[model samples]
Target: MARQPALSASLQPTLGAHRRLMAGLIPEAGFHAAPLDGVTFMRADANTTPAPVLQEPSIVLLGQGLKRSYLDGEVLAYAPGEILVVALPMQFDCDTVVQPGQPMLALSVRIDMAVVAELACQMDPLPPLPPGAPSAHARGLSVAPMDAALADALTRLLEVLGDAEASRVLGPQLLRELHYRVLQGPAGTGLRALAASQGRLGRVFRSIEQMRADPARELSVAALARDAGMSVSAFHEAFKRVTGHAPLQYLKLTRLHLARSWMLDHDLGAAEAAYRVGYGSASQFSREFKRLFGLPPSAARSQPVVPA
Candidate 1:
């Protein structure tokens, strides 16, 4: 059976310790790596402006506060006890809602395809894909209400991650349980398709992986399509169906995301960051960068937070 949150929908089963555990784990307002592998704890003291950011495959759960993500003219607003799952790397605009006294606390669990593949094989019959999720291979992100089973697993996982011995012993099992529960969710179909790695979505995913592997490469859409064993138009349609963005647009956004990371995480200058990401002309790079991130590269260099 699928999991549900502990308390009433709005309360999120804070029954006792989850919020307290997060408080002890997170010391300040920033994204913090946890003791357990593949898990991160996040806290934000103030509201964050909407900005385009790159999100890799992971499970994001809001424990306190609300977050709204914008994509393709649609708005996805999720509050506490709600979870968002992404099957692949994507760039989207995210805005965190928080107040001064009441901060936002969140958790991020990175997806492991190896574990997903193993689980997909073990289950006698895979969970049914939601009707809204088309083609049994559409890949992107989905938000759903957290049920009791998942909420219990997450609470236990947090408790286990708090202690050294418990984290070493039980963390893996709890982590696996969380992923298992998600596999039965609205987003399961895409994840299963990604795990199978043989269908059209699998082929499209490989091309995306190529872009992620080396955004600096001047990859042609035709070449990517050929490698996927599909014609250009077919590949284009399939790619958009799954990832929301067209092939070249996805590549450009990937390059811009890489440049932003270089500037913020590595302190690279504007021109250098653009050049590293395959931008030949600094002027053109700057123009495109601003158009996507809404700020110049220089601003990223000084930005203190990578929002949770």
Candidate 2:
């Protein structure tokens, strides 16, 4: 018989210390030389309160204490040995319960669908997608345990980031290794579905990319359907099936999200931010911004963004 797999142990303090150091390296709200294009580290000390912000496609790993992410009326919690995978864009709030001395530290890796697909191609085939496999709606998020192997791999990757030349040379390889580990976990199938070509999730991703490229361009269901190579009705059904929202609604959300980020990162005024995101009317942009985020553009920008 195959030797029984060893039981995973509690997350040790050493990992926490490494995470603390990694958190110190991340710059505030700007790009830095991260090991991967989509990875960022976070450090916070608090309990129950979270800074509100929009979620993106990424994986969050807690190396110390516990935290919670709320979206779509659902509250998802993760502790030291667990991972959270978020595949769609949405408004989310998260906070930690770790106090002053022992703060909550976490790492986030943005998922690149292209990389995920390539890794899937190289791996052994997974059990065929379940009959009526899980839908790929905008509500695409999952939480699962962080195994020892994965934890160690993440720790090593962070350490590599401390060395400038080594990070430049081997960063991409280590990032791929991290993706492979996620593909081997329970969230694997969910990620594989998103990366699959011609699948509903994949089609949605392509459509979203198109919208992002030209948000101001008028988007019609029929036009998108033609581009997706599906009938209008089929496209509508599949779009909703994969994203939990109608195609038009999805586009609007995308526009608003980009607008918010623009205002926050570029210090753009309401009118300018609106115009940049393809909105012609400043009032219209403000109204939508207030509706989605519970604050108008100027006020929202003044609020603190949750750290990466």
Candidate 3:
């Protein structure tokens, strides 16, 4: 096989430091929360079967091994020295496979929209995105090369994980720096679009919030468009631009995710979970759940909920 492309030279040094820090910080299996709030370290010593999961908006950095995530039929693979930015909450499937001795090591930082908005304001203005450019709604997930500045900032953040005082005093600043670095990178435009409250992306996000508030409510494309103050045609285009899914499709997935949460968190049976999340028919819920998750409700209930 041809040799895989290497990380940029500017990024290599910090990537090495990140690997060492994570290896020392998380020496065993399972997800470990760091001293800093919203920061978590994960390690898996052996390969894992593909599993269904709920992922919130966050930044994921891989320091060792590899992993893959599937969302709406799109498969995204991440290796070392790359960063995965999820700009919204979505349910998806993930698989992480490790060699006999090498573990899959990763760092996850949950996004704080407030912080993201604040950081975006302080950064230099982003260039206008070209027509047909990928936006925050184009699935809300993006993978970008980890540049030297981001790598260094991440390394610094991880280094402070072992010191309580340092984490307390410097953690917030370092976290802000990391977010700033991301806003300055290639993916910055999408993130900025997501944070701009008066922008089209923001309107769609509000519509999403309405659906999340009541997933089972009788909703229509026209109603959602009216609420967003857009014509149906404009709403459809903008919504698809940001989320990569039509409004109705987004609602269906949201409902399924809600039902899954009920089953996993409250131990609700399939029928009860379905009704709780606004499904009127258990059979219909079961069919859709299996179609998206590759398992019937009964089987999905037995699987452990992976931390996002």
Candidate 4:
């Protein structure tokens, strides 16, 4: 990947302030979800091993340090002054780089597709697609250099994050502005493709949303394809092409991820977690969980911690 331009001198102080504010929010090293909606802060103090991470729809902005993401045989690397946008929920192998004295600090702002689509309509329309432009299908994952305006908005958002009243009263408007900025950015292509749900990518995303919303519900490729208004073969191909996983496989991963989260965050037991995710058999859930995560369902609590 081409190296992004360094953060200009004029933007350094705001970037520095962003870093400092994030550090203060997370005094220790771990994944910390802020009181505000859809805001998650993370601090990684140690160099982390490449771990499978289920990334939701969000934009990951680094205050400091670097990260390499491995997905579908493609490796993407990003450092400070760059942002990673996930237009869909997918799994990736993430490796974080933290210097000995300086930990990696980052924050994720979750994306709400409905809100994005609404915001897109409120703004000036995007330019028409050029001749021979690629289809609406998008990778749903992209990295780009952060724009100065976006950086300034983030800094102001950070400034209000620590105060409950400010977060409640001012955060929404600021966050909305950030989303608008994103829609106008280089990384906005994937989002636009997803929002303009008149093409194959949008159809596939529809199925994805269904599976993610109710992972325990009975689902099949044929049914998903039908709902997407495509033949089984066409839907299967489109789903895998965009998400890097087959439809059924994607649903399975979603179930397993949810089950694991239930076990860890909500203190559910393996059997209960499996049942909640529609696993009729605990043994089967354990087997598949171990296959994907390299550990049994019961072992998830014991897995080494990493930034969320």
Candidate 5:
């Protein structure tokens, strides 16, 4: 009980600094691209209506407010002071809420798989999987307490955002350090597993990349299994374990996301977007699009569109 005040005092400055920096950097409620590649700052001034978002594999640090992600009937919420690490592309409904006077503030840094692999090589070998440990599929998204080192690194990273030269010179190093710190934190095991080239999860990650690259291609489960060096049944089990979705289901979601991107970014018509993403029927595409996004493709034109 005696230590509580001291702890709170210690945390006050860091939290206050983060809040100030974010408030100054973001003047409105939307995603703001940072000068650096693969980094974006987000702010929301009030509770948001739930919206379907296709989030890439990334590390998200929340400095204020609360976020809830609904996926596969699971509700994952991350409060301020926690780090959310997503190890795979995820399509989910997300909403944010904040105290009356505060805004939702966060940093979203896309994960560089190559960097993860390089760092994993220098770290100590990971231990064997523990008995009854959750499979990699369900482990794709993790929320863990942020340590001081990571918090400090993130704060420093944002401090340099206003200076382009400093951001160019120092941003990469700080981002690397942030990744290293996360690799050493609670989500490290799952991250390391994903980075291992010969590991089961690693192979699954490779397969995911292929699917994303050409969602329109005729991809067969047998071929994907062969590429992963696993039998069909084994591949199915492993893929589900690592990604939380069956192969066909994952493919469907990927295609639908790509189709939406086409309609928004390229201004493709619904039929054209459907055909481009390998949908054979316009009605089928519209149905799925409405099901996932809560609106038909035609209605999506009015909504704000961001690059996928």
Candidate 6:
């Protein structure tokens, strides 16, 4: 019997363009685009070591090789014709499985909730959301096979980068189209869940933003519950249900991760970083940081920062 084909014709050209885009973006040793506020593309010759505290939500698609991301004790893997959706700030890891001759090349589009909100308003309302769909305690991570429409949109978006004039003129349009297409594809559910008003994940996402903005503020269960418009008990239950961690646990993790980023990117000492993240005791911060990351704060700071 003949082997089945791996990719549909509809997906081939777009994926081809993605492979080429990676080739250009990481022409030298792979580097990340500056963090959190923009797009970044990567191509790696070896598997990467994982990090303990990672934040930011982005879409991941591989053009040439394989990649893996971890969350909540689960390892999510993707490769050609696949996608990963990270919809919240969480600690995770990524590894490129492509070998020497076949480097892993992937594109990451950071999700701006603002952009997602804008696009969602423009989108035709989805059919009634699935029952138990807007779950708050679900993991904010998901993976899916890349379908043709999304692939084509991605291809067109990447092609825009080649023509500087066109990029300026058409970049936003292409980006919008890409987001729309993803929402229409299988990998879109997680995003849709986050975008839908009155949805559990949507509520959780709002609380997440609040917690991120003020990690040190004493957050009352009642206040956060009111923010989500759920009763105190409901809010607490949904928060853990959607994010795979208790609300306070999530806050602590987010703080620890942000502190790590600050230490690596700035001249801040461990104590300073801890204080910034709202920890009153430097020793307590060090203990938790070590437990989570397997390295003491100072030692982790001395290690080179990994380009995300």
> Best candidate, TM-score-wise?
4
Candidate 2 Cα misplacement greater than 4 A, ranges: 1-7, 10-37, 48-52, 88-91, 130-139, 229-244
Rank all candidate structures by their lDDT, best first, as comma-separated numbers: 4, 3, 5, 1, 6, 2
> What Cα-based lDDT does every candidate model obtain?
0.79, 0.71, 0.80, 0.83, 0.79, 0.73
After superposition, candidate 4 runs with Cα above 4 Å error: 1-10, 135-137, 304-308
Return the clash pairs for model 4, or none. none
Model 4 weakest 10-residue run by lDDT: 1-10
Error of 4 at 295 (Å): 1.7
Model 2, 177-285: lDDT tens digits are 8888888888666677677653666676678778888988888999899888889999898777555568898788778878878877788778887887788888888
TM-score of 3: 0.86
Write one digit per residue (lDDT tens) for candidate 3, span 29-148: 888889899999999887776776667788888888777777667877777777788777655678886667778889999888999898887777666668977544355777777888
| Weakest ten-residue segment in model 6 by summed lDDT | 28-37
lDDT of 3: 0.80
**The candidate that achieves the highest lDDT relative to the unseen native structure:** 4
**lDDT value, residue 40 of candidate 3:** 90
Give the lDDT of residue 46 in candidate 3.
75
In terms of lDDT, model 5 sits at 0.79
Where does candidate 2 have its weakest 10-residue lDDT segment?
Answer: 1-10
Q: Give the TM-score of candidate 2.
A: 0.80
Q: Judged by TM-score relative to the true structure, which candidate is superior, 3 or 6?
A: 3
Q: How much RMSD separates candidate 2 from the native structure?
A: 5.4
Estimate the overall C-alpha local distance difference test score of candidate 6.
0.73
- lDDT score for residue 255 of model 5: 91
CA shift at 124, candidate 2, in angstroms?
1.9
